[model samples]
Target: MISIRRFPIRIALCFLVSFPLWGCASIAQWAAPEKKATTSAPVEFVNAEQEFWTHFHAGHYDRIPQLLETYKRLYVLHPDHPVIAARIGFLHVWHLSERMRMGEPKASVIDDATLCRKFFGEASQLDPKDPRFKGFYAACIMAEADIHQREADTRKGYYLMKDAISDWPEFNLFTGGYVMSQLPWEGSLFDEALEWQWKTLDLCAQTKVDRKQPEYPAYATQDFSGAKRACGNSAIAPHNFEGFFLNMGDMLVKKGEVPVAKKIYSFARLSPSYQQWPYRNMLEDRIRKAEENLPYFRIQKREEISSKNPHLMFHSEAACMACHRTND
Candidate 1:
């Protein structure tokens, strides 16, 4: 779509942006078993899991403390189990992330990043080679950077993304790690952001999720690939890649590249992942919104350049639109 260089700087955007296994549970299961096939959980796990699911599904969020304690005890019992540790980490990452994003008081009860490090970190340590844990551990760092604005966390996250993206062969985890690494911070303009988003979008389009399960289901110990499975079906990043495409198209529109942005936005319709926010309307409304604003961005970019840096000229709207005209 629109090139980052031509995209006019815009106001900082704030965008609002899993599972389990345990000891005896290998993170990866190599068997090509049918995804819909159900595996049974032990009585202890089933009972505890039922309670966790009861509150989890009932929307009893205040029960988070209780759930954390329950998972903590499970972790203690399965000290070597990265599965439990990852589950604990997922709880903090998924549940706490929303709370933290809203700046809630209950969110303050624990340091989100610290807990991420504690549980996901433990899982990574226990299974040092697993890409899921490694990538997610890096994700925790990014979360820390987003919430607390920590420089060290950002650097660490960047490094982790590089490593995880390179190391993981899977489509989902690495794409997620890539997006997490590339997402822009307040007032930050990086050339690679758009490219990363494009790649993340492609990954989302290509991924195929077989089963859709509710939250806090009692997942068995062994992972599909054989490593410790964390967060049940929630482990792989959401295939919809909402944050990736949202920022990508918005950035393009801001720069007066509505034509290219429109093409990019079209990919959303092809995606099978769970849709949220702008995607609720099939992204048609968002595309229309961007197109309507195209002229404004073009004029605004020219004006901004003329006033801010008189030495250089801005691309005309005609020139920008010409870049995306169909060849046929």
Candidate 2:
């Protein structure tokens, strides 16, 4: 029944040189396993949330599949845990974000969208007070709409995003604005998104800070303690401040306000995370050639660029990985 003739040259040589003796020795070792080097203690089970955050902050996106399995297994034991559900939901979206950046086929997104919608919707229900859960659920709905070409779901998702923004202006303003940013830049919806970014910056600055200044490097030094978690820099989202300005500047550039856009882009440099941010060169280049890069920033002409290029806010790691990964 065995077919040694089909084996590779290396395997044939091994068989010819050391077959019977090696096989006999392997069988003997397999049957005789009485010796013990030492006794080991069982690993202590850590808090699920703590473990998730540990891996997340370490930029372990590649381990997401394993992480998902671990969470799902734990979810069965703690069915009421909103944090667990939200983590599951976020991971699904994170995976979807990766697939999108890689230019994976649209058909591959359905499973991720479905699971994302389910867990986030569940998280929103379980923790009704946390608007972030609801916001993510609404975003998942919008994603499903795009996947399935459902117009009614589109309207429902938009209205839900609007409501979420009203409920928590500082956090949802950025989140909801990000969802709206996918629209064509020429539309009123895009303008509203741009307005939301201004509102976000205003809220982020608890004290009166000049928005018209040519440089606001003080943003890097300001106190973000009182600001909402999404509004400030943290281990969870190390580059949110910088990413926000990068997005705001690109919006201004698309609207043909090159000088204003350059100033807005400068805000990104003010963030302490700028040096660690892998996309710092992209922002620097945009600031230096704001006028020349205007056409490239517009939504209409993005098709001309490669799908793999991280050119815009939504398309770039700024949307997700910049918050999770140390390197792209």
Candidate 3:
């Protein structure tokens, strides 16, 4: 038995050595000669399209001009691509509008606007019925008119915004509609401005209603209560409604409708949709101010009497508190 085990151990050692040698020979025979390492080529500018949004989100607006130029050059190489055309239009509009808002030099603003108009024009030419193309085109026109500050330009802007509203009623028209409504008033086109504002409010209401629907486009939806319905399926979306509600609250406050304005402001502050936005801070600030001033305004008559009778002593310290309860 000892001899048998010793013999098997010796055989196993021999087989392991032979197996490795055989395997190494086979591997050597199968192996090819190594070549020089090949370097990866740089990505084309068109492929860098997604990076543009990354930069934008990082607040690297200064890089946008060069990025846009690169994108433009790339698009020129692929002019027939519908997606390229749409991207060109969108980038042009967004960058130009943002630049204009930043109060860039008039010439630079104009050049950017011209580029936007051109791209949008091309996008529209590519697909006239594409809602995104039309909406973006109209937005570009309206934004350009706004930056130029031309009264006639504002009229054009208003019409363009109206077109967007008519064409894409499901989309949030907040910026375009707000600007259109305000511009006419600034330009002394009160009647037109009022009409625009009312129209905007109506659209806002409809958008809100649509947002509640389960089938709402994703892109058309904003953070307002109406978004879930408005954005049934799209990807482009709006900011929260805090800013819009604040604007409405301010308007109502100016109109001496404090209670209603307060209610709107309070809603804006409390709404989960708006809790993350900078405008939420603004809403909170406004709410505090309103709360502080509301008591005085509510007792305007008493304040007047107090001012007139400054020397008169009150019968009780709680006299003012009686009318100005914290509940109010």
Candidate 4:
């Protein structure tokens, strides 16, 4: 893997940069009593997603298998439920991420990727109106491309992502941009991804974005109409604002804009949920080592960075913790 500094600095490269409750069902309805070992427990399909976030936020990896089985059962019961399919797809990605982080066999990763693609693709087809499903569908395709080393899959994923962006320009920009962030930081794709980040900010604030100044403080103070759950302090995704900035700031740091990156990093503090974020230290640490951290990050291939690194937003296990934790 080449260092980002050594990679070409094209003009375009300079140009740019969760979760919710299970459903309307009551929490009591979602909770199931412990059953005897011989007896099968009742599944809470309406709030299965809520249970997932509970386990995920608590770092209860051991509980995921049972929850996954529950989701699979729910999917069987509700094959038409796009949300269930999408969530199962997400958990499959998480399952594969754990494998990758642990250096599990390639066969396991391939299987997980295949399953991830299947469910997310199903979700996208079931509800084409939802851009999130479409974006993740494309993400799973790209995941397969990387795992299988297939250029045709890459092209297909890229086109699907483009269509997703066009369909819901606001949120999919972040989604598509995030999937692209794993690419070598020097490429045109990476540059376009940064530009997409800028576009996302403009939409988030509903104003022209100026990179040099601190806009987050104002973003925090002002109330805007139609702010999506993805952009706000959500119970299901408490650290979305924080994670978004961490990602954007990391991109800026890679581009040799450490000072500007520091500004970007501060945006994490704008979230009201920041104090409760278990990964808050990662942001502070990044701010303190903005320039010094560059060499350490540069030595690793972008895709090969371990998810265990708490600071690396996209790949980190903390990515789940960051976005989904309800509290410390």
Clashes of each: 19, 0, 18, 1
- Model 2, poorest ten-residue lDDT window? 36-45
- TM-score ranking from best candidate downward: 4, 2, 3, 1
Write down the lDDT that model 1 would get.
0.48
Model 1 lDDT at residue 157: 76
Candidate 3 stretches greater than 4 Å from native: 1-46, 99-107, 143-157, 172-175, 181-235, 246-266, 286-328
Model 3 clashes, total count = 18
lDDT of 1 by residue, 65-144 (tens): 77778888876666676666776886676554434223223536348667876788788777767776877787777767
Worst 10 residues of 1 by lDDT: 311-320
Tens digits of lDDT, candidate 3, 192-285: 4333433444555453322112121332334444433332211222233344455444444433456766665664443344444433554566
TM-score of each: 0.52, 0.75, 0.53, 0.78
- Root-mean-square deviation of candidate 1: 20.3
Itemize residue pairs with steric clashes in candidate 2.
none
Model 1 misplaced regions, further than 4 Å: 1-43, 46-66, 100-110, 145-149, 169-189, 201-257, 271-279, 282-285, 291-328
lDDT of 2 by residue, 146-183 (tens): 77889999889889988888878888888777777766
